[model samples]
Target: MDSQSAQLPIKIARIGSTVMNDFLKIPVRTEETSATALPRGAAITISGSWKGSITISSSDELSRRIAAAMFRKDDNSVEARDIADALSELTNIIAGNIKAILPGPSQLSLPMTLETVPEAAQGAVRVQLQDDQAGQLLICVQPGLH
Candidate 1:
């Protein structure tokens, strides 16, 4: 692993906390999880000297909660667009933060939601977190193929 790669987990945790706590206004407790089995969710790729991608996954219930929080809508009234926008924005924000600390000169792709985790995500560093009100959140950082 590259030196920067070793710092991934720490970067992820710090950025995740900042994004959730400050931007999302939600506090979370995160733990390492199996990198292989991320739940269905959205991802955004970053390409540069250090190429990799960031993915955000959560349960449907939790997604709805996030959507509500993001859009300032009631959970019961959250729309699909709200869910998609929230997840995409969350991934984008986290990826942007990570890019800053990583060996840079990188560019981020638009976020995309996937029904199944991508093959590129294999061997990714994964972290899982839960919020009392938002349910569960999974974050994965995968290095790109050289």
Candidate 2:
């Protein structure tokens, strides 16, 4: 990994802990692991001097768990919109934090949730964070393709 890529996990852990408080744990970079199939998630693109995207993804179960924590709802009570909105906000916040550390003068596009992982995310740097009770959070950072 390049120097910038190597620094991402530390920023992610710090930002996620500060933003999510007790709801999120420190994220760990998952190396030498097969890709987890993410059928649902969210992404935010960063453009300008550096262009790329930051995606936060996971299984439906984890999505709902994150939504519950974000919305203060019971896990069983999270709605589809809740999941989508929570994921979108989470992705946006992560991307924003990353943008601050990266060579900037960049712009962050509005966040969007996906029902399936995008093909462009292949080969991105990925990290995984586990919740205390149950669920996993996968964060992918893909530098822009010039």
Candidate 3:
């Protein structure tokens, strides 16, 4: 059995909580996990789903709020870089968390730039926080020879 397949749930909870509090300025309540196909917008597309992704974006403008929270000195000016950095951090943290749970010999590939605009699509399981904004995390598995 693949190591990642076994520990996916635990990793999601850890990463989801950290990002929600640190970046989203909210608490993570709900959690979900599943296997699925990679969306066309994704940068890395392997045969089947060779990669996994965890998205932690909030439509409530909380991301803007997070920018403010991160840089205490800059409340009036939150640059696009700040938001992008936060997003990148989110991806890293989620990936790391998942990596921690995976069995030895399995490695997590680095995150690549996702050029497409991210839409608010439902994940395998969408977790809605108390702030009314929901966070979706998806983990995709690569094709394995049966």
Q: Write the per-residue lDDT of candidate 3 for residues 1-146, one digit (tens) a residue.
A: 46654454455665666766775565555433333322321222222223334444443255555556666536458776665565555556555664454434444544554545344344232333333444333333222322
**Runs in model 3 lying further than 4 Å from the true structure:** 1-7, 22-25, 31-51, 73-75, 117-146
Please report how far candidate 2 places residue 13 from its true position, in Å. Answer: 3.8
lDDT-best of 2 and 3: 2
In model 2, where is the ten-residue run with the lowest total lDDT? 23-32
lDDT (Cα, tens digit) per residue for candidate 2, span 1-146 = 88767787767656655655554432333333454647778888888988888888876777787788788888898999998998898888778887898777999999998878874456576766655544566777788764
- Candidate-wise lDDT, in order: 0.78, 0.73, 0.46
Per-residue lDDT of candidate 1, residues 1-146 (tens digit): 88767777877888887888888787887765454444557888888887878888877777887788888988899988888789888888888887788777989999998778654445778877777764777887788754
Best by TM-score: 1
Query: Best to worst by lDDT, what's the order?
Result: 1, 2, 3
> Alpha-carbon error at 6 in model 2, in Å?
2.6
Q: For residue 106, what is the lDDT in candidate 1?
A: 86
Tell me the spans in candidate 2 whose CA falls farther than 4 Å from its real position. Answer: 1-4, 22-35, 119-123
**In candidate 1, how many clashes are counted?**
0
Give model 2 RMSD, 1 decimal.
3.1
TM-score of every candidate relative to the true structure: 0.85, 0.80, 0.53
Candidate 1, which segments miss by more than 4 Å at Cα? 1-5, 32-38, 119-122
